[model samples]
Target: MRDLAELDDRVTHCAACPRLVEWRERVAVEKRAAFRDETYWGRPVPGFGPPDAAIAIVGLAPAAHGANRTGRMFTGDRSGDVLYQALHDVGLASQPRSLRIGDGLSLRGTRITAPVRCAPPANKPTPGERDTCRPWLARELLLLRSTVRVVLVLGGFGWQAVLPVLGAAAWRVPSPRPKFGHAARATLPATDGGPDLHLLGCYHVSQQNTFTGRLTPAMLREVLEEAKHLAALA
Candidate 1:
């Protein structure tokens, strides 16, 4: 089986979606005004965390100027500010901020990944793009399954994306499907002798949610605390 580092390296070189490849590369060249002088990663963003992590975080996709710019998940962005801070408060993160790659920030017993590796225009990936990216996420989880006991999904998009992957990974998802809501919890039965998995839902820390008070720092921290507790049991 490939290690997390190996999977990450492979994910970085992927150009499966022509539209995503063109868009990511174009953004890298055109550049954002503030980061024009800096180089953009301009490629797929791989999952970030240790291989033995007990908890997994699933997000929608990389922000166009965030992970796509820093070459690290949730780094160099406002959403990251909210997320890393909450993780730190819950004792999952080594630091409260994720500035860029090589920022010395680290996670303990937790891994962060996304359904879509590349940043899509308008922060929204089409259904086809998302479907095309499924294998990467599936492969990532297969490698992490032995250690990952809990999953924290951010936003409805992430919730939807992860459910199917969980089934494919042999976790018995309910037929009706668990609804996606802040603090929603679903426990998937183990199949083929795999470990039982806990799934937790939280609102995405996007600017729209944060700025409008839909998802506050306190709210996020609370959910992380719960996830940590659940992970401990696993």
Candidate 2:
């Protein structure tokens, strides 16, 4: 637990990617109209939830005006509205919505994180940038490994990013990596006698998916419930 806190502190101070550093700071300064009076977190965001979480959710990156502004993963974002509601419905979350940091929203037996801690421009991180930010994700997974049984990836980006990290942590990768798609599932056996890992895929809860019916509350809830069941948190 102490190690996780230290990791979070380190993540918050990272300036590894010059483009991400400049862009995040720029967005923080040029406040959005709705948040004109509010202060932006601007720094890299860290994973949120208990250290002993059984389920770990991997997202692509912090939303520029969402986690980037609020300093909490998925908070103050439309994606969060869709995600937290499903989690709540499935009994994995304390509330149905995540607004700001300290909004009393909490996860039960689950943690939410991202491969890229910093908010990327256009809500997309380049391949190089994703690789550069991977060490943090790798370390975080290590810290959570003892209890983590299910890894729920939000999109293809997260699916790709997390697989390598899992491999580095000694979780057995399949001969041919599984493809990413909504409701996809892959079981990763342990190489070091640890618990086997269950990897589940779900479409990102971004506005593009949710607003277009590509991902619905029912769909999201199904995935979350499956994750909960697999993690033995149901």
Displacement of the residue 158 alpha carbon in candidate 1, Å: 0.9
Estimate every model's Cα lDDT from 0 to 1.
0.91, 0.94
Show model 2 residue runs off by greater than 4 Å: none
| Alpha-carbon RMSD, each predicted model | 1.2, 1.0
Positional deviation of 77 in candidate 2, in angstroms? 1.4
TM-score of each: 0.97, 0.98
**Which residue ranges in model 1 land beyond 4 Å of their true spot?**
none
Clashes of each: 0, 0
Q: Which candidate wins on TM-score?
A: 2
Clashes of 2: 0
User: Which digits, one per residue and each the tens of the lDDT, describe model 2 over residues 31-130?
Assistant: 7999999999999999999989999999999999999999999998889888988888899999998888888888999999999999999999999999
Tens-place lDDT digits, model 1, residues 1-234: 377888999999999999899999999999889999999999999999899988999999988789998999998899999899988888899999999888898999999999999999899999999999999999988898888889999999999998999998969999899999999999999896978999999999999999999999999988888888888832
